[model samples]
Target: MSGSGACEGLPGAVRVVAGVSGSPGSLTALRRAAREAARRGGELWPVIAWELPGGEFHAARSSVPPPLRERCEQLAREELLDVLDTMFGAAGPGVPLHALIARGRPGQALVQIADRDTDVLVLGAGHRGRLHRLLSPSVSHYCLTHATCPVLAVPPSPLEAHLATVCRRNSWHLRLDAGQLTEREKPRGRVRDA
Candidate 1:
């Protein structure tokens, strides 16, 4: 409501929520969401969920090794933080960024974030390998299937990445100091070819 929304399908201005899991692909998703929020003059929330690995909860108490287990959990949290730092650093200064940490299933936490806020949510699909296609498994797919708002799946393509960056730079609420959208879009193919 501050200004016209730049990204399509947002009701007006949004409070964009992007889930960061510390995976390489998550940074891609974060960058994309930041751009959208900047372009729309909306708020940006970068959330990291503490998800326990599958079966860890179901294991019997006697079977668990507390020392090694604690180390693994500590490593996970650090990884999440590292990804946040890198993504935010790459986004540079002047782009509004907020960090949120919660404990829950990653998919469930993201879905909850989407449900609570009216902003469009963004998700990243890391290199899931054969398991991804076979399982049809991805955070983006899960959110799109369940979240309340329209979700944007940022593809890994470099051109799409540039569009996201430039889009943020052109955000309605923010000063348009970055390259124009046309200047960044469709870098590889001809306009007609794409």
Candidate 2:
């Protein structure tokens, strides 16, 4: 198994918590996930986890400006919703779509929310070699490992398929580094924007 979190759960109607990073992989994955959500009439939960420079560098700075943090969170929420609209707006109108932005680790935040009712978690694989530490880090790896439900690792456009490849290629390295790994190696299939 991949170096994902230690917990695992059940699978059902495919309620998905798809991470949105606005990258090609993320976009493609989002479209596929949205369409599936539409098909199953399940909730498509979109999440964005972003950390500011202060949070990255000045971790001890409790005096971080409220507005700055708020703005970043707002932007995260907006960007996720926007991506969903731009990719699958047709099915998005009250399509049970929900967008959220967290202030800390993306993977952890996404997992916490998805753990409630999420049956399937979706995320675009990262580029090859980039999955290596300090390079193309993916919180999806964490979700894939920890969530009790079945995880859906969607492949992106051919131009974007490298993420998953690289993720798998770097799986050993990640595990050595204590990075979380997912259960299955490959996803089911690719979903186009509809």
> Largest lDDT belongs to which candidate?
2
Q: What clash count goes with each model?
A: 1, 11
lDDT (C-alpha, whole model) for all candidates: 0.65, 0.67
Error of 1 at 50 (Å): 2.3
Candidate 2 lDDT by residue in tens digits, 1-194: 11123223233444667778998878877877777787777767776778875565575556677788677767776786678678766655355665666667777766776675546678887554634756645676788888776677886586455455566568756543233333446657996789
TM-score of decoy 2: 0.65
Q: For model 1, what is the alpha-carbon lDDT of residue 82?
A: 79
Q: The CA-based lDDT of model 2 is what? A: 0.67
lDDT for 61 in candidate 1 is 40
lDDT of model 1 at residue 27?
A: 76
Candidate with the greatest TM-score versus the true structure = 2
Per-residue lDDT over 13-129 for candidate 1, one digit per residue giving the tens place of the 0 to 100 score: 467888877655677888888888888787677777663444436544446567765665566567766776676655452456555665566777777766645677887765446
Query: Residue 115 in candidate 1 has what lDDT?
Result: 66
List the candidates' TM-scores in order.
0.59, 0.65
